[model samples]
Target chain A: MSDALPGPTLSDEPILRVEDLKVHFPITKGIVIQRKVATVKAVDGVSFTIRRGETLGLVGESGSGKSTTGLAVLRMLTPTAGRIVFEGQDIAPHRGAELLAVRRRMQMVYQDPYGSLNPRMTIRSIVGEPLAVHGLDGDKKATREKVAALIASVGLLPDMADRYPHEFSGGQRQRIGIARSLALEPSLLIADEPVSALDVSIQAQVINLFMDLQERLGLTYLFIAHDLAVVRHISTRIAVMYLGRIVEIADRDDLYRNPLHPYTEALMAAVPVADPEVEARRPRAVISGEVPSALRPPPGCSFHTRCPRAMAVCKTEQPFLRKISPERAVACHLHTS
Target chain B: MTRPLLEVNNLTTRFRTERGTVAAVDGVSFQVAPGETLAIVGESGSGKSVTALSVLRLIPNPPGRIESGEILFDGVNLVKLDDPGIRAVRGNKIAMIFQEPMSSLNPALTVGLQVAEPINVHRGTPWAKAYEAATELIGRVRIADAASRLNSYPHQYSGGMRQRVMIAMALACAPRLIIADEPTTALDVTVQAQILDLLKEVTRETGSSLILITHDLGVVARYADRVAVMYGGRIVEVAPARDLYARPQHPYTLGLMASVPRLDGGGGRRLMPIEGQPPDLASLPPGCSFGPRCRSIIPQCRTERPELIQVADRHAKACFANV
Candidate 1:
């Protein structure tokens, strides 16, 4: 997983290209003189491409490092290794001013709307802060009008701009967060589980809002979520991650209908659909054990320990992402020659 | 069916706030048969948890009160039971599992001690015998190295493993009914499936009824034998799991099911989210609480509230326009 190269790229020049990205956290056991004892490979050799104006979903369980990947893509967490090419520029190596400029066009919306927002700040200030940070603030009156407009776009009334984050419910708080992310009108948005904290009915509203925003703004999205159903609804393409690596990447419908990787298949099967009849009939794909810790992952294939179809070769050699179809790629020994 | 193991009727629980008294669970009623899994599905403020809490008589006194309800267990009204009388049944005849295992389990005590508590208090079993029973209980929950792990504290296990400890504790008394509120909401999907399957397995093995409170309809579909959908502190719909999913009679239920994305595939329509936010419990709208949000609302919906009426052999809903 650590050595994986840039995965198969979808043609037509993607807006964001993540190649062999690795974000590792050092586990140091010292106070004054701290030394790295071990490394937790949070995002190990994961790669994917988001076509312009299309949403590429990154799906995985909690420990699979999907959030880490999103953070690295946003340049919030510096990757230990790899290239993040945004709009034809490898922004991964950029520093200070260069990074700041790149960040103006790439914003992130966090999972917990409450924690992500400042409790003390009003909605107007929260949404307009991004504009001020990016030097887009015109004047007091102009910023107020712009904030109101942004708030209206997310379906909240303009008067709500005067209220604090604590005054609103979870769904409305998420809307305020969305308004803030849309403040700069970033070309590429990384929505990290934006709807996970919402109630089911409210979740629909936020998800539909995302689709509408994408349509109107024509923005590329790196939508990261653990819920497969919601991901399928919003994303055009999906990358299934297993222990910090993309096990499979394919078009949304294609991946759902014909998952090639064992991990992908298991993930798809593991999702509990909302229909009892379908659930009763669907074959349960039971992966035997829990995901191994990222600090000391498996030798060859990270998913080998829990994979139902593991082989002797899977334990010895790490398989490269092999193409089974034009738009589908899976990194599993069963799919590899 | 043989007499329902648990029957609830006209259940109304209220909470006192600075503003006013809020009717959290308003005139809700349902039944759970022995060995059956009944899922009470709802959004965050829909009072599903309140209903479960009221059943267990676990609500905090001054701020919360079961205003009026008949929680009949084996033909006796639990609401009328004395404190000592109810304590005998709380963990012995009925057990409860909470959403987050971390908060539910005491960090100061060992896993074995926590699980053995019901046996120690109710059955009056000696500490040594209780611990022996607890070791067996943990093993039954499929926790590997159960005997050794008994010494481990709550923080020592993963989310999934900690939930196993909770389940082991709930099953310690072989209770006739188990009330699990969002049991797997905090765990990963794979672990969720595992825990659910284990919950279903153990409950069936002991012939105990389960009342599963969850927000995820997927979990309901997969785990529930029957489902009672709650909205605005009332039962909007109740039916056998398959029938409810097949032909939803309530507009709220229909909107709720349709609003969620489908892994199998979506309907022709993109998700049509419910129009408004969840109702504020303190001052709910006069008529139907769902009227403001429901799509198929007629003029009368805003003037007159609906009542749950029989739709089929075991199905009922409270919506007037949807039918």
Candidate 2:
């Protein structure tokens, strides 16, 4: 692996390490020659590490930049600053075939299964494409067997491999996508809202498939989603993002039981409980107004405008992540180091 | 209970799909009392939306038709009402708020004009007088700058604000029944909370019956007085919100409750997902539609259809379980 900077040795390296990552899209103003006027800091100075064989769930509302951060970590989008050290190498500056080589061990499963897969391609070829791309298609017979196994692993029949993408249900389509990701046997997978599009029953099936795959393959995952319950179900650790920054990150149980950040508190409260009696009794703290415009985010704490516990310091100076405990980190002034 | 504001009896709506004639909403019956909130919970293709549309007499013809039903709104059959009679009831006494506010509201017109429409059509009030009422209604829904917002188009409002405008329109003439179809589904979670809070407060204050059609079980649990669980275009179970959650009778209902991951702060068990896909409506089985996926399925279930039988006071389930 080519290193943008000399990273730590492989023996000591976490599976994935993101430090001060920033993904800023330049807003251009021009008809013909576009000039950069300003930048939308979709992901600003976010950092986290996913150890091997563990699932780190990245969760937030829309425009929270969880998806952008996922894309940036995959090196699909170039980051403006910071380091994305995968294994023993910094992937920030990787480009061309070097990046593709690095990506062979890291894969992404998209949200929209219907749009992500080629409608014209057969399920066999769809899953087998990664093998062909990685030049493992010399033995066609062996490749076909591998594709069949992956398809069956995702709970789809090998017989359905020859069928087109449109022939299956939404849940089935998502399974095909997951199977394709497994074709490379990637050690790390970035699944972007994998089951949110699926029905409740089907969603459970797919979510279980992910959990099963993780255990069987020992694959680490960066699971990005907006649903809190689903995240907590599968994730070992959960990171709550608010306006391009991580507001909180803790063990899944700890995060749910006691959230330190006010934004995290509101995000958790906003989720309606499935049990009527419990929901009726629970007092919900409703966060006023929509997420502030990401184009012109607030100076101090991006959330202070709508935050219920906003203080005078919250309006002027930014509060970065501070470790409240050995395992828990919160980005709120209330939780002083 | 004040002679239940609305009662639907054996309502069956069929659609002319590419495959063939399919019963989208088959033999569904329920009642909504005055000041009651009934949540119809189901996934996509479950006919929850069709049921709501059927009650309002808004089923699109040619491809869609209400084959049989008695939608009794104040002792009058809405199914029997003509175009003009139903139009008087539609958006007049029984208003609807759609899932997509952008699509529902005319983008070309100002927010005020669109909201004032019900008052003008129903009350026969002048545009100016109706606009004033619309402004008041908008204010009631807690949309800030309600007066100035009247002049703004639908595009100017945020998703949450547009939903607020939609809610304001629903409350234009103090309608006896308001049917909100996924009213907050398009908004973010925080915004969704705000809209749900606003809708509940307004509905409770006005004492109007609300029929909320949504795929979200969580929303149903929080706001619904009663819940009707629909599956494969049929009402599998209907019970008080608490009763249904506490003790789900039908297999499909139980499976649904188990399938969802509860955020109750005490859970590590794997979700026991229902094994099979929802049956296609057009090629539904002879007897119980859920028979293929049911855990407690018996031989008799595949041969005989079960009618909804009362299990307890105000609780009923249409299943052959322990009968």
- How do the predictions measure up, each by TM-score? 0.96, 0.97
Kindly report which residue pairs in candidate 2 clash with one another.
Answer: none
Give lDDT for model 2. 0.90
Which ten-residue region of model 2 chain A has the weakest summed lDDT?
Answer: A1-10
For A129-161, candidate 2 gives per-residue lDDT tens digits of 999998988998999899999999999987899
Name the best candidate (by TM-score): 2
lDDT of 1 by residue, B114-209 (tens): 999999999999999999999999999999999999999999988999999999999999999999999999988888888999999999999999
Question: How do the residues B104-167 of candidate 2 rate in per-residue lDDT, one tens digit apiece?
Answer: 9899999999999989999999999999999999899888888998999999998999999989
- Computed on C-alphas against the true complex, the DockQ of each candidate is 0.71, 0.76
Chain B vs. true chain B: TM-score per candidate? 0.98, 0.98
Off by over 4 Å in 2: A1-12, B265-267
Poorest 10 consecutive residues of model 1 chain B by lDDT? B266-275
For candidate 2, the iRMS in Å is 1.2
The DockQ value obtained for model 2 is 0.76
Cα deviation at A236, candidate 2, in Å, is 0.8
| Best model per lDDT | 2
